[model samples]
Target: RVFDVLVEGQLAIPALDLALEAGTYTAVSRQYTVKVSDGQLNVRFATRQGATLVNGVRVSERPDKALP
Candidate 1:
């Protein structure tokens, strides 16, 4: 399945296919840097091909190391 993710109403992840990147039932992760103007953080997922599914979501401060 494929989908798009939006954070704070802006596009963050586009055309994500979990089964193609990682095998079914495997874990895959993606991280993005976004500034929170408001106290709330919104994450929205839209299906591109099939139904979109998410296992979990995590929110934390940016790490010292930069993302590769």
Candidate 2:
């Protein structure tokens, strides 16, 4: 499946395809940095090709070890 990830209504990921990147049935981890000005974090996935599939999502405070 292919889709676009939008953070704060802005395009973050143009097209994400798990099958192409990690193959079927494989787990992949992705991280994105976004600043929430309205105190709300909105994550939306817009379908580009097929259906959108997401196993999980994690949100946390900016970690010093994580790159921006």
Candidate 3:
């Protein structure tokens, strides 16, 4: 399955609850979207000083075992 996310013309991530299953990912700088497939958990992110961190890591798509 595939999911399409659009940040539209906004420059911030939307505040909502989500759950990912496994699929694909697509994001934009400052404003973007992500997609995941079934059985894959949706990863959350936080921006600090223009840097993106997934589960406190400096990169995205980390090992599933490395997740909390």
lDDT of each: 0.86, 0.87, 0.34
User: Ranking by TM-score, best first?
Assistant: 2, 1, 3
Q: Which is better, 2 or 3, measured by lDDT?
A: 2
Models, CA RMSD each: 3.2, 2.7, 15.1
- RMSD (CA, Å), candidate 2 to true, equals 2.7
- Candidate 2 per-residue lDDT, tens place, 1-68, comes to 89999999999989988899889999888877877888889999999998887888989988673545
How far off is residue 34 in model 1, in Å?
Answer: 0.8
Q: Estimate each model's TM-score.
A: 0.82, 0.84, 0.18
Candidate 1 residues lying further than 4 Å off, grouped into runs, are: 63-68
Task: List clashing residue pairs in candidate 1.
Answer: none
Per-residue lDDT over 1-68 for candidate 1, one digit per residue giving the tens place of the 0 to 100 score: 89999999998889988899888999987777887778788999999998999989999976653444
How close to the true structure is residue 61 of candidate 2, measured as C-alpha lDDT? Answer: 82
- Which 10 successive residues of model 2 have the least lDDT summed? 59-68
lDDT by residue for model 3 over 1-68, one digit each (tens)? 22232232232344322223322353323322333445453444433333442322232464563424
Backbone clashes (count) for model 3? 7
Kindly give the stretch of ten consecutive residues in candidate 3 with the minimal lDDT sum: 1-10
